[model samples]
Target chain A: MTALLQVEQLEVVYQRAITAVQGISLVVQPNQIVALLGTNGAGKSTTLRAISGFLGLDDARVTEGAVRFKGERIETLSPQDITRRGIVLVPERDKVFPNLTVAENLIANAPRGMTLAERRRLHELVHQYFPKLAELKGREAGYLSGGERQMLAIAGAIVCGPALLLVDELSLGLAPVAVEELTRRLVEIRRELGIAILLVEQSAAVALEIADHGYVLENGRVVLDGDGPRLKSHPDIQEFYLGGSGERRSYRTVKQYRRSRRWYG
Target chain B: MQLYVNIAVLASIYALIACGYVLIYRVSRVLNLAHGELMMLGSYLLLTTASLFTGHPYLAFAAAALLALVVGALVYLFLLRRMTGEMVLAAVLTTVALGILLRGVMVLIWSASQQYPREALGWANPAIALPGGARISTFALLLILSTAAVYLSLFVFLRFSRWGIRMRAAGQNPLLAAQRGISLHGVYALAWGLSTFTGGLAGMLLAMDSGLDGTMVVIGLKAFPAALVGGLDSLVGALLGSLIIAAAEIFLIHHVDPLLSDVVPFLVLIAMLVIRPWGLLGTKEELDRV
Candidate 1:
């Protein structure tokens, strides 16, 4: 079967001089949670932005690759048009309208191809996933806790009825308990809605816990890629990302490990 | 009591005009310096429509209102659209240039004559005496009533309607709004339309009460300081600001010198700026955000 979403050797450039993402490729199958893990400036967020058609705001562009949604080229589409095409992104920051009430934030989403009745039903369904939101429906979103704001962000994206959801930095600024709860909710959302998610994160442990497939990025390139179990146990991921190794490896060995492509091939 | 009634009428006029500034500024962060010119243009359109739709006062008024809405939307579409991603200062300057151009064009067309639209529409500005020994002109009463209706409807619409919520969302964060599948251009165009429509209504009634000429633009300009004093982004602030400035203007003209009428609003504006630059109800963060 064909992939639900595909990014082929995508290259993103900022301000015509800085190339933030260099020839990175990935895919998400139907109902799968695919995690893109990288540290600061590793191009994980850029790749997601490129895929979700959100790079325009930052003067960034996907210069040398194709982002395909269900076999259709969509790299040139506007963000709202991309959303209408069923790929909605829950951005890293400023995720909810601060002044708007919680219920207004949920209803602000212009759902793709959903009737008013269907949209209301979807709102109720999302409220079920986060009952706390229902209770705080009338309260301003600005007054929400960080975890509740994250919940509202995710629920707001869910309101769009997306076929492919792009989540950027799901664990950033979140406590471990909150991250765990969010990851659990994500897994349940994938199972119930059958929506594919391309989750970009720096928290490898949290991401790998629920991701069906995973890729590790370093310096704008995908250095390693595999299924969750395989990548989780890889020594490099375990050492650098998962923080499993206590003893420091020699710098020479680390350089040699990066140069070797035996495991990637 | 008469003085208070006069102040109320003047305040309603300023409030009506100031809300237009608040609307466009809140959405796009553009000052729309041409708003006074646009407001004058609205009354001029009413004049032309009044002549064409002879003996049909209601029809002519409605037509002129609709035309004002289109004119505003067109201004955004043809001119302001290009400035969307430009610097705010440049956008504001563009509006200033547009205002000068509009004033020139209006002078050319109308010959700078003070025309009474009430005569064209065969309406009389009757003086109605209040029980409190105050008198209100017919158009002044309509202006006050229309201002109340506009404010109430705008309050409800912005709070309850889906698109209204979307407009507030867009105003707060344009990027997030676009990501949520909102068409920014559409929201902006709607705001411009509604703003110009309300502004036109104020202009038409004001022209009926007195008359319209280049001086009407000065009143429009005076009302802008009211918007800034109240908070450039808040409609309720505009109302309050208008009342404050109008009270100052009315009291100074009545008690001190009538010539002070032209300078009183700005004096109050300066005072507000010294105390709180963001206006009474405006968000402080908005100062840097703009």
Candidate 2:
């Protein structure tokens, strides 16, 4: 089976100097939910932006590697062109047009050449997944709670009729309950639409709960990758990411200890 | 009554031109400082078309208007489009340079002589006497009506239309708009096109009312103060700002020295800046962005 997206040895450099992502690679098969887990500045968002064609905005470029969407080379395409090709991103910050109402935000994102009936159907599909958005249709997106904004961002992306959805920091600044609800909704959206999702997340637990496959990134490289259940049982993931160990250790001892990362060849 | 009529006419002219500034600035956050020159270009196009069309004044006028829209969009496509993702100041400076270049080009093409588009189009600007003995020229009345129509249509477009909402979305957050598949270049081009179209209409009408000359550029410059005073992003603010600026200019010209006419709008602008830098209806956060 062909992958929806393939990033082969991707390296992104900012302003032709600082390397943000150093030859990291990952893939998402059609209709699969793939999680890219990393902490702040681990090049997770940079990788996502590289795939989404937003590198140019930050004076960054794909120095070495290619981003392929459904067997087509799309590394040099513009954001709009990339989106038109059916990959939509729900950005981490300033995700929604704040001044626009919820309905206007959704209306603002119809893919090129979409008919009115298709638009209405997509709108209904979005509202069906995020019913709270239907109630907040008249409210300015700026006034929405953190979770509602995320929902609207996703809904807006959905309206674009994307084959792949890139979600950056899905659970950022949201309550646990809200995050769980959103994750469930994301699963439902994926199940119904049969669309692939490349989810960038810092919370491994949240990502692994819904992710079909997961990759752990550290210092701009993929340290480990596996199917969901196997990744969940990995000791390094539990120790560093999930905080599974209960026994208290001295600060000095903990600071001195370093766990060897099992790098994937 | 005559004072009120004069105020209304001047206010309408400023409002029409000021909305051009508001439209471009609101969308791309770059002030098209070349707006006045572009406005003058529209009048000149009308002059050429008038002679070309010969007996058909309406055709000449429509041709000029359509040409202005195309020119506006082309300006974005060829010139301003390159400035995207660059610093906002650089884009604004590009417009400034464009204005100077356009001014020079217009002089070479049309010569320095004042040209009457009204005469070229074979139309008479007869003043219509009002009930209170105030007279308004035919084009000036048209200017008032056109301003109202443009503003009403723009308000409706921005509020209810899908493309209009997309424009607003693009203005507020260009990155997200692009992520959502709305083209930034397309939105910016539309803004430039609409802005130039309206500015061109004001120029065409003003030239018909009063002969077109280099001084028309000053009128365009004067409208900038109106847009700034109302908040550069708000159309309603542009209307209110134009009224305030026109009222100040007309009343000061009547009550004070006539020489104060050119300085009055700038004075109002300075006062507005000192008192409320964001303008009356403009978003408070926009001041920092500027």
Candidate 3:
């Protein structure tokens, strides 16, 4: 299958200091859930942001490489331009328009210039995916729970009907039940809408559980990239992730590991 | 009745200018201290337009609006675009620079002498008598119509249009708006263009009210009181606040003490800041930002 999105040797630098994501390369196949996992500030977010064209103190001025979305060079495109090309990114920090109502937030940055009926129909699909948002359609987004805000932020991006959806984190500060529900809906969105997804997650277990293909990022490079289950059992992965040298300690019996698994479950 | 009529007339003019300031501030978040200078530039645009040296009156008015539009675009690109500051003080200072540039240009074009746009076309200046026994000039009628036209179209465009949605979203959350694929540059450019157009309308209306003069630039300051009273976040607030400000200004002049006239609007501003803080209809979230 052709890669839906591909980044080759992409490098992002801040001033004289290079947060060198040295020679990192990755591919997101069509309709696949690709997870990027790493420790805090592991350059996983840098790569995602570079791909998304988020122009802040950071941007997509690759020191030496390219990012292609749907076979087009999207490296230096504006965030808005990237969205128009059918790749929408929901950044970290639940960046919802807190003052806008949920329904308004969903439609605020919607694909502009569509017919009214078409826009409304699209709104319906978004509401269908996140019923919690629909229930609070008229309420200010700032009042939403953290999980709900995350869900609404995702809904806002996905409603654009993108070919690929990039999510920063879906389970941060969320209840386990809610996380499971969100993961289920994301899976539903993939299967039901055939949208490819690229996710940046801190939780290796949660990401692998839902992902088809996964990559582990360390510092600023892809340390591991392959099938989820294969990487899950890899020795270095087990050491770095599964608490080095501990044998098959099932999370159900281990309360210490359970803290890392699920909050409610 | 005459006093009430004057109040209404003044309010309408205030609304026209207030809308301009609101738009520029919303997207750029810059006070556009030069906003008054834009108003000054609009008067010049109208003066040159009315001179026509040749064309008809309606043609002149249209021409003036078009010229103001260009001036507005240039201001955004050259003067206001690269302006970024640690706090708003930097942006406000840039606006001050823009204001100085415009005033200098105004003197360059029209000289330091006071002037008014020529009433080349006979369309305005015709007379009308109100049922309240107040005689209103046809110019007042035109001012009322133009103000309504601009405000009504703006209301509809913002409330129901796509660009308006994008513009409003930019004001609410520029970072998130950018994430959704709304070009931040495009948003800023559009705001400047639309708001500058309002400045022209306000200039034309104020010219119609009395006459275009250097002092006429003060209309921008007058709009501040109007905008603040209406809640800077709201387009409707501009109009509502203008009416309140204008009525008070006119009444203070007519009833209480004429010397207290200029003081009235600021007093209202102090009262609102003390009392509602959200103006009449501005949202709590917006007030928090202020």
Q: Which stretches of model 2 miss by more than 4 angstroms?
A: A249-259, A263-265
Local error of candidate 1 at residue B160 (angstroms): 0.4
DockQ of each: 0.82, 0.89, 0.48
Please, what are the lDDT tens digits per residue for candidate 3 over residues A187-217? 9999988999998888777787888998887
TM-score per model over all chains: 0.98, 0.97, 0.85
Pairs of colliding residues, candidate 1: none
Better of 1 and 3 by TM-score: 1
* lDDT of the structure predicted as candidate 1: 0.91
| Per-residue lDDT of model 2, residues B1-290, tens digit only | 99999999999999999999999999999989999999999999999999999999999999999999999999999999999988988999999999999999999999979999999889998999998999999999999999999999999999899899989999999888899999889999999999999999999999999999987999999999999999999999999999999999999999998999999999999999999999989998887744
Residue-level lDDT tens digits of model 3 in B222-284: 678788888887788888999999988998888788887668888998998988887887665
List the candidates ranked by lDDT, beginning with the highest: 2, 1, 3
Looking at candidate 1 chain B, the ten consecutive residues that score lowest on lDDT are: B281-290
Give me the TM-scores of chain B across the candidates: 0.98, 0.99, 0.92
lDDT of predicted model 2:
0.93
Q: Supply the DockQ value of model 3.
A: 0.48
